[model samples]
Target: MKTIIYCWLFLFIISFNLYSIKISVGEADISLRLTDTDFTIDNYNFDPPIKETYSVEWEAIDNMTYIKFNYTGQAMGEKIARGEKRYLVLFSK
Candidate 1:
């Protein structure tokens, strides 16, 4: 029973790690992370900086995957020099 429990725990950890993605630019103070169902971005280049996380919706089409999410943070609008934006991200195996 103990062995079975340990095995399951190990598998869970491995599965979680397999589906997680992280990207960082050297000395840019910008990073992005995507998990199984969530997406996050951290950018410290703005006047007030920006760090927000939004739920991700994904769809599989042909050999590619599409990820969509909305950002309603301080970095939005014309005053900040960035207007309403839409991003199309594609992920392929």
Candidate 2:
């Protein structure tokens, strides 16, 4: 019946949304170190570090927007050279 189909579709949509919990992350200033030549490198293997997994959060205090992400990833893949910087990002499902 129509009622059963509607219920099933609604449940399906809800479950799908729950699985992802998409969040958008953006900021003006983010920095990361440089590669090679630098004493600090990912795992010290001379390879690019893997992108880290992060939990996203946001806050607003008197017109200042603050976004924070907790990294659950290894620092092995994220290394820049001296006096350099890079933006780190990740989307979770």
Candidate 3:
């Protein structure tokens, strides 16, 4: 009986840890339990006819997610922007 209960508990813990969740923003999807710290964002609405790719760094603290992003690619054969943006987003499970 004890071995059966231990097996059941192990399965429960494994199943909980294997769960995956994601948050979608526009055309981007972010993982809730992300193993990677960086992601890329692509903007399709550009006036210069070039899509811009932004490199974003993310971190989670407490119940909020912190994000910082900057333009890291060229647009229309030129640099897109020269600024960094930060955001603190609240999420709930």
| Best of the candidates, lDDT | 3
lDDT of 2 by residue, 5-53 (tens): 0001111123334322222222112222111121211222324443334
Roughly what TM-score does model 1 have, to 2 decimal places?
0.37
**CA shift of 45, model 2, Å:** 8.7
lDDT comparing candidate 2 with the true structure:
0.28
Residue 36 of model 3, lDDT score: 47
lDDT by residue for model 1 (1-93), tens = 000000010111234455433322222332233445544455565566664444455556786545544443444533222222223443344
Judge candidate 1 against the unseen true structure and give its global Cα lDDT, from 0 to 1: 0.38
Q: In candidate 3, residue 50 scores what lDDT?
A: 43
Better of 2 and 3 by lDDT: 3
Report, for every candidate in turn, its global Cα lDDT versus the true structure. 0.38, 0.28, 0.45
Better of 1 and 3 by lDDT: 3
Residue pairs with backbone overlap in model 1: none
- Candidate with better lDDT, 1 vs 2: 1
Tens-place lDDT per residue, model 3, 1-93, is: 000000011111225475233545445554433334444555554555444444556667886666655544456677645556666644344
* Candidates sorted by TM-score, best first: 3, 1, 2
